[model samples]
Target: MSPFLPLATVIGCGVVYHVAQKASGAVSPWPVLTIAYGAAFAVALFMLGLGWWGRGDAVRWPAARDCVASLALGLAAFGIEAGFFFVYRSGWPLSSAQVITNLSVTAVLAVTGIMVFGEHLTGARAVGLALAAGGATLIARG
Candidate 1:
């Protein structure tokens, strides 16, 4: 697998999750998320059992500090997923919500890069970011 495969998989999962959440909104968000997470955890455990999570023949564990950080990150991720499921059930259009959410996230990251990371954006990237922000605004208004 290529290095970008995981990133693509994550994006695809997000899209599918939004669609499923919209379709399953008649049901409770908690139940839906719980089932989804349970399934995902099962799959992950299965992969681990099959020895699919490490380099060729090595299984590596992180440091305690890293494990703690990862746990916090996982908690935050679950919170976001739960919140999004609820928002999906709240009658938000999938297209609008996804677009706005993605664009807003991109905008925040771009701003953070500029402010915190001191990353410089070229003229073209700046224009693209502006267009993206405008499109997200239009989507949210729709």
Candidate 2:
């Protein structure tokens, strides 16, 4: 699978996500998340029913460790969803919120990937990091 397609999916969904988040600024975040998660669960269940579960392992139930990882991911996703709601409520414009968050996440994950996962910080990645920092600074100043 081309990375660009998945990246584009995130970009497209992210645009809709932020718009919906901003639109729901008047509502409590938890209830909103609950409904959103419910909808997501339904969609996932439907997909699973369609036999499109995982990459060869989706048919089998996940192992305990995999479940644990999924739990951790859920917590992090909740934080992200709720955090954005609060950020939006606190007056962050839609234009900058996603950009800033993505940049920050990319930087942190880059460091974590290198330090924890022993991924190489190749010259291209280094340049990308530098460029991201520069872009962030410019966005923040605007």
Candidate 3:
């Protein structure tokens, strides 16, 4: 199977997941977050077990510096998760919030790709970016 298939699957699942989450109404964000993370951890553990028990490549631990970096990344993740919880509590519409946040993130990434990664944007990519920007502007106004 091509790589795009899995990527598309993940993106589709993410959309459905967010929609389901928003439809669930205003529950306690902390408990919800806890459960979500717990489930994710469980999945990771299951994968690890499979790799260990079945494949016999149990654990390749990271280096000390990598561990420290991961710790910092975990902190950043927690911060963003907490911020999203607060934003959800603020009664923002899910669609609007998702669109605005995604567009802003995409814009930042596009700029970063060009500047830091030295990526060349093709004509098609430029057109797509322009369309995305225009759509974001309309969404922001609405």
Number of backbone-clashing residue pairs for each candidate, in the order shown: 0, 0, 0
How large an RMSD does model 2 have?
Answer: 2.3
Best by lDDT: 2
The estimated TM-scores of all candidates read: 0.82, 0.88, 0.75
How well does candidate 3 score on lDDT at residue 36? 71
Ranking by TM-score: 2, 1, 3
Q: Write the per-residue lDDT of candidate 3 for residues 1-142, one digit (tens) a residue.
A: 5789779988997787666566655566777778878987898799787775456675888899999998998888676566666666678777677777777788798889999999988899889988988997788688
Q: Write the per-residue lDDT of candidate 1 for residues 40-120, one digit (tens) a residue.
A: 899977777666555445546779999999899889878878777777767788889878777878889888999999999
Give per-residue CA lDDT, model 2, range 20-95, as digits (tens).
9999956688889999999999998877876653444447688999999999999999999999999999988887
Which of the numbered candidates is closest to the native, going by highest TM-score?
A: 2
- Name the lDDT of candidate 1: 0.80
Give the CA lDDT, 0 to 100, for residue 122 in model 1.
Answer: 88
Native RMSD of candidate 1 (Å): 2.3
